[model samples]
Target chain A: MKNKSIELMKRYRFFAIMIVVTLAILVVKPDMGVRVYSLAFNSVFEMLGVLPPIFILIGLLDVWVKKETMVKYMGKDSGIIGVLLGFFLGSAAAGPLYGAFPVAGVFLNKGSRLANVFIIVGAWASMKIPLLLFEVAAMGWQFTLIRLVMDIFGVLVIAYSMEKILNDDDERQIYELARKMSQ
Target chain B: MIMTIIFYGLAVIGLVFSFVKSREKTKMALMKALKAFENILPQFLGIVLLIGVILSILSPQQISQLIGENSGWVGVVIATVIGSITLIPGFLAFPLAAALLENGAGYMQIGAFVSSLMMVGIVTMPVEVLYFGKKATLLRNGMGLVFSILVAMVIGGIMS
Candidate 1:
């Protein structure tokens, strides 16, 4: 029981510290504290709304997608098909960038090519289609279209370069981490 | 939003199909998801709270002043730095960028801010490091920061 409680504390240390900090702020500056809570709560509410289905999809992918299938579609030799799929998957998603990490873990666990996973993340970060529409509306079609074109190129460049920079050992370590996390 | 509807629709369809195919596998999938979410909950809470604190402190008026018209490359640098640190959702970010632009913030600086806001996340680095390790996280964000500058330059040249 004691050990379990200790483990829980370790897991929650950062959260606990932040809570205390928030409380201290509340004491010192009630207005600021109220703003903090409202903003934080809003975000938490939004996250709660979005994350469940994403996690479910991730879980399904982990359980259903065979390693061979993932490798064939997204592994090192999957080529342009893999890249397009990565881009599509990333662009189609709805959620924040952090939500992409666990899904990326599933991809890694399924033996996806490093570059493809990187593309997925890059797309998730900046190239999301729905967000692009929003961008276009706000910034004008010219700005949005140009940025979109450049960003596709940017995503590819970042993905491939990052893949090249990672040595075999580093790749292995990341793969291992993914494998452990999903299990 | 339409995106949320699409996500839920897809998830429901996928879940139904999985259930039909194999109840056991569906169960396993849900369990794995719950475990993954539980594992990250603590870090997620911390990150969100940090974002709230940062955003509350950096009010919209302050942002407009920092990146106002004629603020130039210095404003771009400041905007990019602010973007990198703050974790604004893309939906809110675009509208806010519009509001900033209307309030006299330069397009170049807004470009830098939007690009960095999407790509580079300093506050969420802890969650990223959990998945990609320390070195990769730093390298990716570093490269992202550089790329955001390029994006700003391109937008500036074209729009100006």
Candidate 2:
């Protein structure tokens, strides 16, 4: 029990330090400290609201989707269909880029192609539909359109290159990490 | 708001269907998810606090000053670095970027900021490395940094 508690504290050391820093800021700079609390509260609220369903969906995907089925759609030899699906699913997502990582973990656990997974991450990062609408409204359609075209090209380049750069051992290690995370 | 509802609705519907098909499997899935989430909760808590502190330190006014009209390519580099380090939500980021743009920040700088803000994540590297490992996470962010620069240049050329 003592060892487990110590391990937990080690894992949470960063959070503890942040709390201490925040308290110091409260003493030294009250206004900035309040801002930190409010921002942190809002983020925590958002995370609580958003993460449960996402985790449930990931869990369901893991349980219901067979490895063979996943491989058929998103693994090696899945081809253009896999790429298109990755893009579509990512663009349709409704959460922050961080949220994509856990989902991506589940995908990797299920034997997704490396490039396809990277494409999903790229699309989630740069090309979500709601985010695009916001960009167009705030930055003008011309600016949004130009960035969109460029970002699509960048995503493709980055995804393919990331996949190609990984040797078999590196790829295996990543897969092992994903398996551990997803479990 | 609506997105949250949609996600919950989807989850509920999927859960119901899964339960109807097989109660045992549904239970197993829920257990798996809870375990996975528990494993990462500590890191997520740290990330939230880190972001809160960083954003408080680097207020919008401070950011605007660094990347305002005369800051040029130097501003783009600084903006990208700030964006990578910070972890603002999309809802907040767009408005923040808009505010900076209106406050005399250059198109190139704002472009770099927004692109890098979304594509690169130095703060969330621990979470990413959990699944992708250190090497892949670093490579992706390195590539993302390069791409964000390209994005800034293209936006600067066409928009400005």
Candidate 3:
């Protein structure tokens, strides 16, 4: 009985919180539940359909993507070229959020710099030239161009600042070693 | 509905297997389910709340007005920002985008919003921190937000 209670508490805590929040909304705003439930359920259904495929893809990637190749190109010793490669590869492989999760996790464990991991995920989740082109054909070229430029520039800043701000000694050591070798 | 069934079926299979199999295999299945639940639940609720706000405060007509094709670059920017904070899959978002387009919302704005909404999420901030370290999470989300805006605008501009 005690064990069961503890397990239930652990698992249901968040779900309880959700219920309380929903109830609070109901009390504050009559009929809120109707709209919220409608929206939430629909969104949930769609997300469910997408996540499994994304996870399967990531699982396959883990199995198929050669570890040695990742080391040779995206290894700790690699430089700016490594960063560029990371960016392009991430952008090219854009998929669901769940998909990127394990992929990023594997990369982190395998010596991919935290900074590059950050950038790759950002680029992958956000940038996809082919998809953007479809959106552009619908919206406008000028708007599309401006937005793309801003995004790339912003990602660069984000990657740089995250590296600097996190202030991890390990990353700094790698960055400095790479910098020294170029000179 | 189908996913729920699959989850239940898989869960039962997992349980029965665990019951018969070694502790190691059983533990692994439990861990996977726990991980999936951990990732899905909170952000899922967060999304529900945000959608509530949009529905209660902004009418479907209002959404069309604000994100209208003629709303200009500023409208696209606003949509992109909104999208970054909201988390939804492409399947739902794209369909909604199709509808919004019919309703007079610009493709670029929807595009930006969709990309950002899926890619970036303030809603999942806590989970992201737990999954990825604080700095990495912040940096990735920050970039996702910015890039999504660009994606929307570029898509919008080219199409328009």
Q: How accurate is candidate 3 locally (lDDT)?
A: 0.60
What is model 3's DockQ versus the real complex? Answer: 0.17
Candidate 2 lands at a TM-score of 0.96
lDDT at B154, model 3:
63
lDDT per residue for candidate 1 within B122-143, as digits (tens), equals 9988888878888778878988
**Alpha carbon lDDT of each predicted model:** 0.90, 0.90, 0.60
Q: Among the candidates, what TM-score does chain A have in each?
A: 0.94, 0.94, 0.70
Q: Give one clash count per candidate, in the order shown.
A: 0, 0, 22
TM-score of predicted structure 3: 0.63
Name the weakest run of 10 consecutive residues (lDDT summed) in model 2 chain B.
B38-47
Residue A162 of candidate 3: its Cα lDDT? 71
Candidate 1 per-residue lDDT, tens place, A22-47, comes to: 99999999999999999999889778
TM-score order of candidates, top first:
1, 2, 3
Docking level of model 2: medium
**Predicted structure 1, TM vs. truth:** 0.97
Please give the RMSD to the true structure for each candidate, in Å: 1.2, 1.4, 8.3
Native contacts, share recovered per candidate? 0.66, 0.70, 0.17
Segments in model 2 whose C-alpha atoms lie over 4 Å from true places: A1-3
| Lowest summed lDDT window (length 10), candidate 3 chain B | B1-10
